[model samples]
Target: MLELVKKNIHMNRWKTQVDTQVTLDDDFIVPDTMSDIAQVILDSGEVQLEPARVQSEKVTIRGKLDFHVLYRKEEGGLQTLGGLIPFEEMVNVPGLEERDYVSVSWKMEDLNAGIINSRKLSIQAVVTLEVRVEALFDTEAAVALGALQKEDDGSGELTFPQIATKTRAVNAAAIALRRKDTYRVKEEMTLSGSKPAIGRILWMEMRLSGALARPLDGKIRLEGTLLVFLIYEGEGESETVQWLEESIPFSGEVEMAGAVEEMIPAIDLRLVHKSIEEKPDYDGEMRELALDAVIELDIRLYEEQPLEILSDMYGVNRELTVETGEACFDQILTRNAGKCKISEKIQLSGGQRVLQFCHSSGLVKLDQAEAGEDMLSLDGVLEVKLLYLTDDDSCPIQSVTELLPFHYDAEAPGITKDSVWYLEQGVEQLTAVMAGGDIVEIKAVLLLEVLVLQPVCQSVILQAQTSPLDRRKLKEAPGIVGYVVQEKDSLWDIAKRFRTTAEHVMETNGLTSEELHPGDSLILVKEIVR
Candidate 1:
């Protein structure tokens, strides 16, 4: 008889990803307080997502396109205006269920805003939303073997001495938590003496980079730098548009209910919503800028578990029939990070001349990650948009967008074609400057991160049926025998094959351990019963 011990494992059942495009069309009339639009210089936007609702084979996501337009006024100055365009989309996912967990992320693939007239603006945007669904389930794994029961026919209790077994160590990456939440970040900065106070806002751009999160005792500590750039009309006599760039370091802790130390954390964070406004400083002058942002966190935690399972087993004194089956487990291969640098020069056309560089923004798109022999190859493109000041009187500002392709290879030993991976990439640094004539140089540093996982399939003993030994074979067996150790042979294997215990064979051969060498001679002694 065989006694099996089992463990319950929580694992991912099914996961799938799908994307959909959402379009926004709207027209806006200029407010009386703001100047009429002369020429649209640059337009940018971000997506704001709500909680996705899941139904049978379908998911509905609702969000808005928060767009901003910087335009040259008819009176020879720049002004900023923005609004929200709401959208709703439903996508069909084949295996999705109502209770499944879903994560929704979006990017503005294309956004265009032009002046319908001097007093009216036309806005159009195409937003791509990627939805990921995960279903978690539990399974029982036969981990180990325990003591067997005795027969009622005046026989002793069965034990390991009467049977032989082999075991192997198994490692697993068990899921601890999968959740999505939001954290609020509020910060304020005052302008220095070298910079002028704000008369009116023209354009503002804020970016978060180099963010890291650590799991502590029931909380998560996050640290990063917020880059803020502002172009505003100064309150001085000139009333000219002056630019100021500031880097603010932010640190905060988010409350997580069951987080603890030493748990592997793969948390992704992004800016979901943000607000920037001018405020009065201590001297009652509008010299301070207040920033409030909402950051969305997608958290995944895994714990390492080690277990010993019976690989093979057999009876020594009884006829046993053993059954085995395979068990699937998830194990972590590696967590890798690398950087890719992109440098490109773009030439201006249509009689455009660069007066000054305003801002540069980039997005890293990971198109594919292919695994080869002991290596992980990454392919992606860096989409960069450059905004600058122009010398032309009609169009004082112009923007350029370019795509820079990048390929990176990271060392991922022991990776195979059957492995699963997840990638997270972002732009760490970006800069734009005039190289000469009408040529502009753009450089960016991209951070690439990947997590690889391999599924393990192990055969384990499921059940064992035992019966009394055959009396005829026992009578016909020799009382003493001679054996020779072969290559890759163990004392346990010799004993089990000869229907004897390892301890008995070791005692007969005066062996202190079960170690054996090839071509070694040994004597097997067994007492025959009839």
Candidate 2:
């Protein structure tokens, strides 16, 4: 009997992307203290996903759309209104089970806000969700093969012959950790004396930049900078709209049960909730701001493992037959990062003149991604939102949105259509300026990162069947003969066919290399069995 060795591999089982749209049509009532709406200026939205539930053949996703609206009051100034709309969706996924681990990710494609009445507002948004499943199983291969025999020592231990078995090294990536967690950042900052005190906060936004996670012993260290922007109403008699921008550095650590420094980490970070509120300073004036942010993290780690497996085996005395089957493994292809630069000009219509550029935000939406002969082609659109001050007295604050299309090709030598991959998209270094009375110049650098994993299929030995050699057949076989090397013939294959060991054939023929050419003559010698 031949001994067999096996190893367990963790890999992706099934993956799919589902695009669904949820409409949140509800009336938002204006507060009594705020004035009625006359004209809407800007509307934006953000999505927050709840803990997903995985069942047989389906996944239940629940979330809410948090939206903000900036409108000109009928009484003559700018006011803000905000609300939340809840949504639930059921995604149909075949071959999914409760015990399987599922990963869910989502993005907001578009959001539209309209006015229904002076006291009410209408809001709607579209979202897309992606799902991936993973599993673990064992693969059996003949790493070493030898007949068991008692040792000559008195201990009587069975030992394997070193020259009878051979092995080759194969590398694979194994999963070490897959988990999800959240972290909250609480900070406070006081405004400089030169800046005016805030009466009320009108609009605020926070973005996480240069975020990274590193693994340690039983923990993961997180570090990033927060880009904070806000516009508020002044408390003094000036009563003008003032804005402030700040970059705050933050760092923290999260506990991961089995994380280690040697593992490779792939982390996804998102800001699920954020808020900036006004607080009174030591002088009893509202000059300080309190910042609270919630970030959700989806983390995965992989460890590279080298496996030694038996490629082929044969017996000199006994007849041996090897059984093989197909197996698949997920191999890491590459982790690449690239950037695209976008520059465009917007011509304002309806007699609108730009007095000052306030702020700009960008979001990247991927439309297509395909793998070519030696590259990965990506097609996407960058949605930019611009806010500025207009020269018009009636509507001093104005906002506009523009879509810029971009195409980028990354160098990926061996990528294919069946490859498992993902591209992480973001915006960085966004700037907007006025070129002329009606032309607004916009420039932004869009960041793109991709990770590719390819599945490799190979034939592996499953088991070995052995039987005693027939004496009559051995007697009829020739003891020595001249052999001609054919095309694509290996020394192991030729030796096994002639009932001899490869070492004996090489020693008898005095060959220096295993490279065999057509019409090459070789001498064969049969092995004698005891």
Candidate 3:
């Protein structure tokens, strides 16, 4: 018989896999009715994946990519082309059964679109997808604290040692909520005295600046803003290219039952269905426009689970058997933010003057991260790219790329070196200005979200040793002998086999660690006689 104690435990875990070789190859030809293609520009692209279908041997996934293409026509000035390409593939994963939850994400890079001739175009892009499968459950473990009754012939009664324990909060429950809303924007603008009405829209982009979600009694309130920028050509004598900007605010409520203010919400916003039709009006020598779009917000809700964990235990009088398991729990959630800027004093290579830039794009990447007791240290690089036109009043556009190194220290309370963290970074704003000379100033905001997890070990006592009344056992001789260590050998197992304690063997062998090689020599002194 053995002593028993019970405690509540919570565990949350997920295993993720990434596939980068998702083939994305498609070709489109310029219609013979339209003008010839002069220059092809890649504005932006996004991939949308459906829920994964799991089978016995492999999983099937289907998705589509939406990309906008800008082409300068040989006869016409500029034209915008949009296309939707569908793709599907199968991936082999062992032990992947049906009814398993799978979350998917994908990114596209290194896109190349070449114009073979004025009528034929070829496009190729590389896509990477990440899938995470997760499951949550609750369980209990029984631990051994102490016992008072025992009978020993050669040993006296001993008290039980203190048992180490750990407490944590895991994922108790989770749910998903989805909502879609529409936005309407309209504004009046003015051009130069010689500029004409808006003839055509060259390129347009929409990026989320900031978003927040808070839970109510039975609903979730969401708030955010979208930054809309566009490049349009004026119907003037020179047909100049103009840059325009607008910030649209949106707020709404989503229905979610049993949701409280203490729960955590993971937000994913997408342009599931949208239409940005342009209606330009000509007033004397200026241009006015209106924009409209529909956006969707997908959120994941999670509840915290608190647990008490048993770490270590032992028995002095009789042999003890312990059953242990491993689990992971959430530790902390903190938002880190900072502003980093890069300013340089340089001149143009040639005698070209600098016109107004279209837009500044920024991307952040983390190279290394370290965690301390109360803070996190991060090392990363910020890459900035700008597109600008020269002073020749021509239609040629030039581009430049820059890299900035940065280090940030974020305060994380109650975080230790043993915890694991997951990070997601976003850019708040990016701007570039022509400072005095050919010098350019670039400024950006960096936002980081971290999720920390702590792993715990749970143990329970299964059985205790039974004493035999008959004393007909073999004995060991007391002597000091030298033994050579071999593979698959441990000091604890050797001491138990020789009827000696591990402490006495270590004191005699002068060993610092238990790392024994095949040719290492050890001295064992057996002093117990039975």
Candidate 4:
């Protein structure tokens, strides 16, 4: 009777599934010109001499003059040679009767002068000097003789090396001059540029076409190569990666200290040649701008992703594949500045399953979508959330049967019901033992698939049962008997097929080896008898 009752009992079970898709935001665009600007100053006019010395032949004369030198920096700051003299243009005048000396004085004046504006003026000048020599002689005859000789000898080389001779000298002094004078200056001027933007100036060649005057106009022509730094932000917590750092030749024009009210137009530039370098950590700091200066920039954009995922997996068992794509942007700047991009991921759960997806790694292009489709065609892992299945006692068949009552046939006397019947009965009993079986507890597992998709935020959930099965027939079916092993059949696979334990098969076959030869027969004992 027990066997018959068991045979009439039933068993029940459940399964869950989930799917997800990711997309990018399109609200962001390249910033416009004039957004990034700051004050700038080029403090000018500091002079330095290489070596200070007098002519070796005129040691006793002690003659030296300063090379009045100065730099016209961007800022209008003055530096001067206060007490030092230029050694190149110094001279000694022969005195008369051993009692006379030459005296010299110097001054500067602007030959061309003009008013630049209400607050500033432009000026250019040449320096001039004067010299005087006077003589005193205790012997009038010696002074007279020296005066007579000075007029006769125009070469100025004294004939007698050790004579007490002095000669009166009067002449315009020689002076050493710089290349040019007068530097352009802007009043309360400010300068600025962009950082963490596309492109870099590789080799800059600048030439001053016109001379700069104090508080006036100046211009320069610039030419160079720019290496473009491709910037990209990720979808999630992943950081922005630079795919390409390339250099391209470019050229443009520059002007400074124009009319104070005149605005400088943004210069348009272009690249003429291409070159590339591998710089992994270059510009890691988004805020720092290298090679600070205002110059026209030309850039070459690349379609490549720099990050390479080494490996990834979902949970402890499931392995995942990764996918990648690249994009780029280009622009110009007067100075250096930095910028940023953002991304996010969402997660949801139901019963014993979870679902997850992310919008990371900047914009998703059509090619990336096509690549994903190709992966699907090639049996590649999908870049979506997985449904994790966790086994819990709360959802036992016995508990399910008790919650949803079902009819069962009574066992007849003398004959036992099939093993399938007994199995069903066991499932019902186990399900009834579970408390409040209506709500099944679910768990989730997250995973990443390297080379498939980076920063893939994924999750799995336990969904509710869709259809309930009858357990009566399951209890009446004949149990599987010993069976021959196939070429690739495993103990776990065989056990699952018969709802039996691997231990039973090992013990029944007396199998000391885990390796099973084809055609080998093994016994199967059913674990869950309905």
Candidate 5:
């Protein structure tokens, strides 16, 4: 009689111990939650065990039979077992000395013992093993500042300064295993946020990928969010100046291959997962995470004002007084070739009494003067030189010496005209004194306002013996002719100048080459020989 027993095996309870110490040359700074770790798990399907009972003359006992096993590494950390071993051919059997431990062994099967009657044993069991694995990861760090402030509106101002900071890192791992390994791990966490108007922040974000044991020598796609902040300026005199401030956000990405140590700020990092956390403070606010941070800042100011202008017009002459003595009066009168002086006492006034007497060839005649209740008016003819002065001052300063109405005729040596000279025409031709004390000459252009005479061409009689020449003779005639210099003028310009065909010019000039030089000249004949 044969009997059968069924046993259940708990696969989760099995543990494989790999006792090996692996040392890294440097201390590994375990990155925050953003760091990535590379590892693999293999599955070894159920193993079968058989219970066999062997009957002998001495005693009746049952012995477990063993089976042959073959294992092969497969994709995704999987192993396969093949073949079997017969109980009769087994020289030694690996058994379980204690309930906590079990030893397994197997051998190849031969064709001779193909069939056995209640001799071979097959058992089902689960296998779990632990292997030494290492992963490599790269680390990085980054920072940014805000604009400076001044105390006053002008360049030199004293005010409180503020700045913001940002930093990030990319934690990636590369798998360095004896065989190909594949498994999934949780993605890294990224942190990012905005800063307050008054405060700035130091922000950073990191991206991690690949295995963790060996150096990361593969391409990594870096991606992540940006922590933004707005550095605000302080309020002014009134509370109305304290309005809502705005914050700016930034985001970007970077791609890298092989190993990377340090990363620059404001670079985007590729990541599998990310999270953001916001923290507020009294002076400012900060957004931070295990891998990233953005700092807020508040800039304060006391007061600012415009700079005062300093006046430096010192020692400048503002007024002048003229005293006319007897000798000076007589000298001035004698120098005037055509002088007409006032016979009676004359007082010049009216209109602020600001006047300057200048002479080019004559003198001024204060013929009459009338003194009113509060003003004195004088009539005079300014001869030789014309005097011009601002109405604010009563100084005889010469403005334009040659501007006086005077004439030098052969008959009259120096004669003064009493009439005022007006610029009736050619006003544009007048030159004015520039601010630099130099005369700027201007061109005088006269535009005709009336119609002018038009020229008339009359027909001419030509002595033609046989027939009258066609009126289109000028239009149809070959304007000019020239030989085509193999390397002379271009066919286009040459043809245009002669009003002829480019093909004709090319054929006439060349016979061959298209290049031309300076010494090479082409003949341009007129259509009409005359």
Candidate 6:
């Protein structure tokens, strides 16, 4: 006879489509006729991955991204061109079962653009798509009652609770903020003594500063400064570029139940639509610029749950053997982040003399990660683009791509090679200057956040029960027996080996605890009621 045990376990699954290349082509007409092109820049690209379908040996993901291409026309103005690129990719993930929860995200690593004609252009980009899933599996478990030591009473029954463990990545909240605000200012500096008329807006950068996300009143309250930086071509006898910076205070609320400051919240913001028209009201100079922008934000939260499990058990003293089940459990051992800074002088490429440096900006992307005994090593790239003046005073933009490698080891001593990692690299501060030998001396502070997950395989007891004694093989035993404890021996094992009760053995030997030492003498007195 055997006891039946039942348990539930939670686990996580995932698939990745990393290092995938894609092509984007567009044929757009500018306001002015085709001529010499000044510059081509990708304003923004976004992808929204749909739900994934898990197959026998793979997972299928489908999504589309909206990309924008901005260029300068020969007639001293900027042109805006855009198109939507649809994509589909298949990833191989072994042992994927149905009925698993899945989440997906897409990221852009590198993009290269070229001019095919006056109104036609071609762009290529490397995109990475990742899918993660959470699932629940049911299992059985049981432990046997102690083996019979005395004569059968035909009155004792046994019972045990059903115990199981499940691990899962739960979504805490989702936040969507719609902000419609205005910025009234007369602060940006003009190129000449007089305010030259604004020619064309070249590029704009939106950054969130001093941002705080907290849960309150069954909703997520976000407070931060929406910083807007604008670069434009100031119209004059000679074409000149001017810069304008503004910090617009914004406060909004979104409904997110159970959202707190500790749970990980990933925010993705986009300038869905924007309109800025210059309005100079009777000042005889440009003073007020009406600002209107539609900001779209997508926020998803995730939390990890890890637990301990119970496997098998058997009755003592009675004849019994336990059956166990084996499985590979995937769990998030540790998921955390830390703040870091990387300071180094980046060497310039060749004989370019620096007259003056205008502005510096960059993006940090994690490429790969590896784990040691107690540390996690991360590798990534910092795509830095600088706008500066040459010795000849040419204002063409010069870009540089550099590698940023770092190691993170703190409060982590159990990290192994099979651990999976993630990063949310943020650029806190980036300051630079032109050195004596034309080197770009840079001082950058970064928020190097990391997430580590280590999954291990363990076996648990499935079921156990007592093996009945045969009446035909039963033999009459003597009233007393002599016993000697040996090395690596336990009271329960000794009692089970001698077919006697542990309590009777301890009481007879004058034992105080469950401990037994080698060469210790004991007397076993059996009180059978046959």
Number of the top-ranking candidate, with lDDT as the measure = 1
Q: What is the C-alpha lDDT of each candidate?
A: 0.81, 0.78, 0.59, 0.24, 0.23, 0.55
Give stretches of model 3 more than 4 Å off: 1-11, 93-99, 141-199, 233-240, 266-274, 280-302, 305-328, 333-351, 365-385, 396-420, 436-439, 460-530
Q: Which segments of candidate 2 are over 4 A away from where they belong?
A: 12-14, 136-142, 150-168
- TM per candidate comes to 0.88, 0.92, 0.66, 0.17, 0.15, 0.69
How far off is residue 95 in model 6, in Å?
4.4
Candidate 1 lDDT over 496-522, as tens digits, reads 788887888889889999899999899
Q: What range of 10 consecutive residues in model 2 has the weakest lDDT sum? A: 152-161
**Which residue pairs clash within candidate 2?**
143-310
What TM-score does structure 5 among the candidates reach? 0.15
**lDDT for predicted candidate 6 compared with the true structure:** 0.55
Tens digit of lDDT per residue, candidate 4, span 334-437? Answer: 11111111111222222432111111111111111112212211111111111122242222111000011222222222221111110001110011111132
Position 361, candidate 5: lDDT = 20
Estimate, for each residue in 1-530, the C-alpha lDDT of model 3 and write its tens digit. Answer: 44556544433444445454676778887766667787774445677778678778467789887777777777646676667778887877654445445556665544566788888777677777666554444555544344544445234434332222223333322223323333333333344455456667778876665655567768878677767677778765657666666677777776777667776655555544433445555544436555555555545555665434345443322243455555334444454444444444334454566777877776676767899767778888777667777675334555566676777777776667675555656667777888866777777777666555444433433334434222234223546777887788867656655545566677888877766777788788754332
Best by TM-score: 2
Cα RMSD to the true fold for all candidates: 3.3, 3.3, 9.7, 47.5, 53.0, 7.3
lDDT of 6 by residue, 1-530 (tens): 44343334433323332334444444444335444555673355666566677787567878776666656665645556666677778876555557655455666765656677665666666677755544444322222233333433222433232212222322211122222222222222233445455666666665554444444545666666556666666655534766666767667776665655554544444444454555554644454556665544444444443333444333332345656676554444565656566666777774767666656666767765667668776666665666655554332444444555544443446788776555556666767786668677777776665555555556655655455443333346656888888999978777665666677788888888988899998897754422
Error of 4 at 101 (Å): 87
lDDT of 5 by residue, 1-530 (tens): 00111111111111222321111111122224321221111111111323222222111112222222211112111111223222221221122112222222221111111111122213333222112111122211111122333322122434332111112221111111112222222222222323123222212122231111211223222222232222112223211101121122233222223323321111111222232333443445332222233211111111111111111110001111111111000000001112112111122333333332211122222333333232222343332212223344222221232212211111122222211110101011112222222221221221111101111111211111111123364447565554444444554545444544444444755636545565666765442210
* lDDT of each residue in 299-415, candidate 2, tens digit only: 877776677877677656666677878777767777788888988888877687778888878778889999987678999888888888878898888888898888988777789
- Over 4 Å off in model 5, which ranges? 1-480, 483-490, 511-513, 521-530
